[model samples]
Target: MRLSTVILPVRRWSEGGRDQWLRAESLGFHTAYTYDHLSWRSFREKTWFGAVPTLTAAAAVTSRLRLGTLVTSPNFRHPVTLAKELITLDDVSGGRVTLGIGAGGNGFDATTLGQEPWTPRERADHFGEFVPLLDRLLSEDSVSYDGTHYSAVEARNIPGCVQRPRLPFAVAATGPRGLKLAARHGQAWVTTGDPKLFEAGTPEQSLEAIAGQIGKLGAACEEIGRDVEELDKILLTGFTPDRGRPLESLDAFVDFAGRHFVLGITEIVVHAPIADSDFAADEKVFEQIATEGLAQLAG
Candidate 1:
């Protein structure tokens, strides 16, 4: 299985951000992603940076380390503008960009733009519209569309993306509607286990939940006559009941990864160590995992 890391954009590049990204590349991470948000929870009071700009800087400094947002959402983004930025980012990164997108939750981003948080149904509807429109905006030179939640009138993205039709999309979804969208448009699928199990569920329960979600994803692909294996199944760690267990040691991580790999997971993403934070971990062990975890798993 491929191993990757998520470096939260909570530091200024000159201060320490640049080193984290450079280290990720040197350690052979498959991709180093960041949370795409104006300000994430808890980090709201910290030195959070914008995702695109941070990624652009990272792209300038690193080679062979793919970069992307753990997720970008329609919470405060318009497809037309986002497409333009992504096209440029793809070029900047030399076609090493994957868009991990989702139907945003009712978090700080939901109301930071002076709008009420969307209901579950409304979020689903907006996401359904957003993904397709963004797809067209990136693939075609010009696009014009009208929908309940978004519109694009003669929008132009000339020269398009460096990744053929467009860069790859890693759709983050667990629900039926969202999974259907992922099956239809994604090159990969992402999940952080189940949120309901984050606080009170056991690791075993989390495993079962993820297995069910994968089964649904497979069914969704089958419905469209697409092979489920065509899409990489990625598990972004730290949100499940297992939380930091997988990163406790090389053996712990290998065991954790092996269990999920058996369930058809092709990629596992862990958070880069952050001292005294929710994502806090031993930097040495993290680097070790980055360097040797996959090889050990293979052995």
Candidate 2:
């Protein structure tokens, strides 16, 4: 299974963020990501940088590792504007960029934009329009369209993406509508499973919950007449804090990876041990994962 890590942009941009990404690449990570959020959870008061620029910088320095946002939502970004940025990032990364997108959540990103809270149905409808418009913008030139939530007026993508047609999209989903959207449009489907099940549960319990979620995704693919095997399933490890002990050691990570593999996850992205702003501590964890965890996998 391919391995990745989500480096949260909760810290200051100047504080070794670039160095940490560089270290991750040198240490054999397949891809590295930063969270796409304006302000996240309890870290709202903290310094947070934009995911696009952070990932762009990561792509500039790393040649081997693929770069992406953990997930970008349409809450605060226009699809047309984002498409232009993503294609440029794909070019700069030499086709090593993936767009991890979602229907957005009721978080600080939503309310802070001075937008009203949308109902679940409204969010799904918005996502339906958002993903397709982005697909057209990157794949076709001089696209003009109008939709309920977004519109593009004769938008010309003079030079298209390096990845051809468009860069890869890793779509995050859990609900039926979201799952179907992922099945229809995503190169990869990403999930963190049910939050309630993970809260105060063991690793084994979390695995079971994730398995159910994966099954739902498979069902969604079948309903849409899509081959489930053709889409990559990405499991987000340690996504919920209350999911018992975090996989901090190589053995822990290997065990987690093995379980996910058995559950049909082709890729797993682990969160680094929260080192706050300490890049050295973060680098140590990444180095060990490369040397020990990946070595264990290889062996």
TM-score of each: 0.99, 0.92
Q: Any runs in candidate 2 off by more than 4 Å, and if so which?
A: 11-14, 240-246, 276-285
Candidate 2 local lDDT, 132-234, one digit each (tens): 8998999987799988788899998869899987898999988888888888889999988667765565666777887887888899989978888988998
Residue-by-residue lDDT tens digits, candidate 1, 87-149: 999999999999999999999999998999999999999999999999999999999998999
Worst 10 residues of 1 by lDDT: 38-47
The residue-level lDDT of candidate 1 at 143 comes to 99
Angstrom error at residue 204, model 2: 3.4
Name the 10 consecutive residues with the lowest summed lDDT in model 2. Answer: 239-248
Clashing pairs in 1: none
Q: How close is candidate 1 to the true structure, as a TM-score?
A: 0.99
